[model samples]
Target: MRRLVDRLRYLGPAAGFLSLLRLTAAAWAGDAPKGEVMKHRFETSRIFPGTVRDYWVYVPSQYDPARPACLYVNQDGIQYDAPAVFDRLIAEKAMPVTIGVFVMPGRVEAPSPGALDRFNRSYEYDGLGDGYARFLLEELLPVVETLRTADGRPIRLSKDGNDRAIGGSSSGAACAFTAAWERPDSFRRVFSAIGTYVGLRGANAYPTLVRKVEPKPLRIFLQDGSNDLNIFGGDWWMANQEMERALAFAGYEVHHAWGAGGHDHRHADVVFPDAMRWLWKDWPAPVKAGAGSPQLQAILIPGEDWQLVGDGYRFTEGPAVTAAGEVFFNDPGAGKSYRIGPDGEPAVFLEDSSGADGQAFGPDGRLVSALAKTGQVVARDVSGSQPPRILAEGFPPNDLVVRHDGGVYVTSPAADPREPGKVWYIGPSGGKRVVDSGLRFPNGVTLSPDQSLLYVADTRSHWVYSYQVQPDGGLAHKQKYFHLHAPDTADDAGADGLRADREGRVYVATRMGIQVCDQAGRVNAIIPTPNGKVSNLTFGGPAFDVLHATCGDRVYRRRVRARGANAYDAPIKPAPPRL
Candidate 1:
């Protein structure tokens, strides 16, 4: 009933909407056991704020309160006769004892009949990002748990994301995938049929992002036909195929069924039972992340993940590791520096850091920093005992890199829009010279492993400029070398800080994640932060194999296959690229 009403929002009056429903017969057959369905209306949402919607709770007759039931959530209020299908599947022992929750998109009531009520379906379903996912986990799911069975059995939903599955059709399908994609720890299995993966919003970028970013543990089944919607937004048929290919390329456990139907639920209705069977095939077994592209495989080590090291900082930045393997990061907003000890616990290293933004460790064991608030560059001892030696000042520096010969290159982006950003090179004698200027926003300066080249991230563009570093502390042969990926919702890559590995690979901290590029400047892989916001990074640990990143208010570290190259150390030529 909620499904029919949701479709009527775009279909005008109820008399006409009822005509479309008559085209299809009731989807269930007598072979499937009749399961009980209860209708529900939801009016409270702190996430959506003042929105109302309806939902349903389908409880299989085989459900016993002895164990918590596995959860299956569907969008757009239950198509495909899911209650009956669950009845047959649970009775046959094909799937586990599950509770299904089908929810409708929220809508805010209008002031009057003539005024248009704001419809949230397209906004909630089509847009990208974590808002919709939060709505499900923080809002809807909690309401579903409050529901009691007809026999007063207390409802319990499994806490594990692996014990959950979600599915939907059309725009609802996109919403379902977004929920799983954003919170894979909460929903592991996805069933998307006739998904609006095209440019209805930023969802069109999913195929590309799925290929570039690290793979997550998800088993997805897609169903679409060739004759689906080819409207102004995008071609549904081609978009679905692209999604399948991207998932396969990323090494996900993906399955697809192609047919000759339209955008309606005709094809999905026919194959949903089979899809459910495959989605829950090997119950009680965990789904593992795939090693999809060789690029991701080259850098990321198996069985290692991003580990939380520190949290509760005002805003963490400037991750630098010492030769002894101690990881240090600064919370410039709080004017403090923290050190991650061998036991992975963070302790305050400096109580007042002058609000540093970028940092690197010198060969003499001092920490060099680009101080943003004081408009100064300074070096200080790792401990809080000594005073900082001022290197340079009077410029608003965003990031900086120190070289083997004690030379420093700093990026000072234009504080005012009317001015051009500049890169200042400080020679060994502490003489400051403007090596380059007129960039939109230069940031995250670093040197190549051999010290013969320099790289700078231009925050206003998708390109990272590379330059030949001359012996006299000058730069030449400047060109846009590394091409980074940006989000569709943003104009720039948001590249913040950069570092080079011993293999000459560069990692740029961007809004999308950390894009790892080879010597030839081609992005090979993207490693995302645990919270989806990455700023500055450096390599740490005894072997320099641990990549530590300053992500917003927290700091995280992940052990990778590659080791880091320190600019302050002796220059070592890395192996040549594969052209």
Candidate 2:
């Protein structure tokens, strides 16, 4: 009884509130311009799988068949009196002629009468990844374009991200932000009300990630209440504030509206009209990515984005640079090797690469490789004057590094999951020994700037193990030093190739992107690749300041501020890490 009275007091006579939402646009504008509303059902979601959902599309009366209309997507099948608000705004020339999409959460039907249906609201909305974004871009939005208006006018939405906006309340609001965060190229504006930015589905990491990742080109308006929910997931009010603070800290263009109400949509509904104006104030002007944290600014140069160096390969990996700064990479699936010189053009260097997965230059000016198919580590001169010399021939090394002192270390994953991975060291004089063993899947291997420590990426877990390099070419005191972030759908970080810079920052190729960590073993920044997949990276180009990444079937390069620390060169002790 008290709850009902509090709600009545807060919302004030439900009938009047309903009347306020249903009022004709003629109250504000001279005429009430109406739009065509159509409802449909969608069940073919490969991303969410076994989920069926209903959605509605609103085509404004002013829509033209030739010009593509702007877009607004709302969750929970539309709220905040959007149709009337859109009519008033469009009639007054405040917002653009936009096509609106209102969708509901998905549900999977139960096979038996005794079982309850599976609801996908929390799974799709509260989680973080490219899944929901891909669903909208690949599945839902595409199906929307196939529909038509009442008069048979085709619905055409602008492909430009600047012309799109997404909004919702509660979990839907979180989904709106996640979609834009993952793909700024698709949706760049967000309207979040009472967002569930808590630990319901790993959304608690957003505050930390926003402060660490390079900022995307997005403009967001957040709305929450002072008396929101304080459940086991997290404090809604505090999480929204943390999000606002983190966005501001990373230099994002964001706005917020706080109320004294609880976890309901009443406050958000009252402020809905104004939020639209603020979100679309500057029409046609593109939202630009902001200057990121100091850590990101140090590595990513201004106006230097990822540039494609090569493509259409089977699979590119094992990028290494010669002393003169020429870059070389192998396509093991194609059984070929390629080289890129100062001209920035790639050419076939070796006709046959012996199916090598990782390679590095040695102090002796010889290029050494870890051949996966033949289970051998071989070294050869670029001149091809001498045949390849086998350094080791038993374990199949996934990655290897050669130090300035002629020390070679390689990571070899076990043949079975029941066994542990091994790290091997081949001395300068030639015999190889198992320096260390016990990692789940020891992959990419590299040495510190001073060659005093060795780093190896354990792909089966979210850890990059570090070891003290002993004088006798053996590892000692191994520790799970560098922590990494995994995707919401995966348990491991998918850490692969790794390399250290002269500044003692380690760049790791991961599923979540390139996680750059400081010497203290803390991830300071995340730089995602063009295609969102990276296998390996190395410093190359004329000045050795260019970063070349092997991304699946493509290769990309970018100029940066930091210099790569080549293990084959003389070591220099870096400044001590900040505690």
Candidate 3:
């Protein structure tokens, strides 16, 4: 009877909306054992200040406080009659003994009667980044943990991501996916119904991102209908199809159901129970990340995660790798530089680094560093046998690179935000000049594999400019070549240190992680650091096949498949890029 009613919901908006209540009431009529629904309000949120919202906690009868139970989080309060569904599923052992958290979108009250209240549904649920996830993990979940159910029973949830799941409909569905996408370490399962995976809040990029970024350990169940929304935002049905295809192309564990109904929860209500069965099949067994697209697989090695090389630094950056596999990085705030050699242990290399912000190995077997505070670029032998030689002075260089011909290029960010930053080139004949100046704040500079092109990251924008390297090492034909993705929290990409691989791929360390762009300049993959902060990275290891990144207070390294194409080495033209 419930399924028949839901199937007929597409008669019209007024009729469909009316039919939904019947489904809800029917959910409450089942003879299945039930759980307690505790309603609560959250008025304090630092992430989305002044916003207040209500949330409900569904504590299953089978949940035991002694053992932490699995968790399921849903947005836009409760839908699909989830509590009754959970009651039946738990009793039948079709799913784990899980606790469900149903939350409404936030609303900020107007200061006075004349102003309208600020609604946070679209702002919170449709935007990309870790904001919503942080709100849940750092704010809401903690507050819920403090609550006590009847009979003094406590609400204890499992901390393992494998034990957690998130789901919702429409924009809320997009929110659920974003939360899991940004923090796969905290939630590994997603259920998206009539998802707003369209241009709303940049979510349309997910189809492309799902194929480019390193795959996360996630399993998803998507539900949508052919007759769903097709308005200014986008076609929900087509977007869902793209998502399903993208997931399959990337080898993700994905399941879906198609129907002829319109944009509503009707179709989902009918398939909700079966979706849960498929989602939680093989309970306690972990969901796994995938062998990504060939592009990503060509760079990342399976079973190899980022390993901490060193920590306890004030701020680390400017990773430089020597030919013999030694890696060196600087702590600018601490005014120190360190080296990791054959023993794989970091040791102090230079106690007085003169505020080195970026460094690279020179063609002459020397280390060239850009001293940000001292306004100098200096070269020192890796063996520490000679005094440092000043390559250039009187310019605040944030990062620099040493070319194979003994030439040097430095990025000098303008002290004033109103003025554009400048790129400095120091010739092999010992002359320095400003090559070009236009980027908002040029921070990281590198050369192409063939050494015929230069790439510079604008720290204040989403562009990584590319220029043709002229005969005299001057730059020409500048264009915003590499387009990067910025975090929702920031105005720009915050693009920093840059590197190129032997395969002609450019890696730009940004706030969103390592945005890897192919020769044609489109981002092909995003590799995030373990700490979600990567200032700079360089290919190192004995074969130049390991990636080392300086991630603010910690340095991490991961073995990969590509060899570093150093500006200091002989130029070898890479194969043409895939268009």
Q: What stretches of model 3 exceed 4 Å from their correct place?
A: 2-31, 110-116
User: What is candidate 1's TM-score against the reference?
Assistant: 0.89
Query: Candidate 3 — which pairs collide?
Result: none
Q: Model 3, 1-579: lDDT tens per residue?
A: 655655555433323344455445545667667899999999999999999999999999888899998999999999988998899888889899999999999999999999999999999999998999999999999898988788678999999999999999999999999999998889999999899999888899899889988899999999888889999989999999999999999989998877777788888876677678788999799999989898888899999999999999999999999877789999999999999878778899888888998889888889999998789998898777898999889989899998999899999988989998899999987879999998899999999999999999998999999999999989999999999988767999999999999999999999988999999999888998989899999998889999999999999999998899988999989999998
> Best by lDDT, which number?
3
Instruction: Itemize residue pairs with steric clashes in candidate 2.
Output: none
Question: Which window of ten consecutive residues has the lowest lDDT sum in model 2?
Answer: 6-15
What lDDT is reached at residue 42 by model 3? Answer: 98
lDDT for each residue of candidate 1 in 271-295, tens digit (9 for 90 to 100) = 6777888899999798778996888
TM-score of each: 0.89, 0.94, 0.94
Off by over 4 Å in 2: 1-30, 110-115
Query: Cα lDDT for residue 258, model 1?
Result: 81
RMSD of every candidate to native, in Å, equals: 6.2, 3.8, 3.7
- Native-to-model Cα distance after best TM-score fit, residue 293 in candidate 1, in Å: 1.2
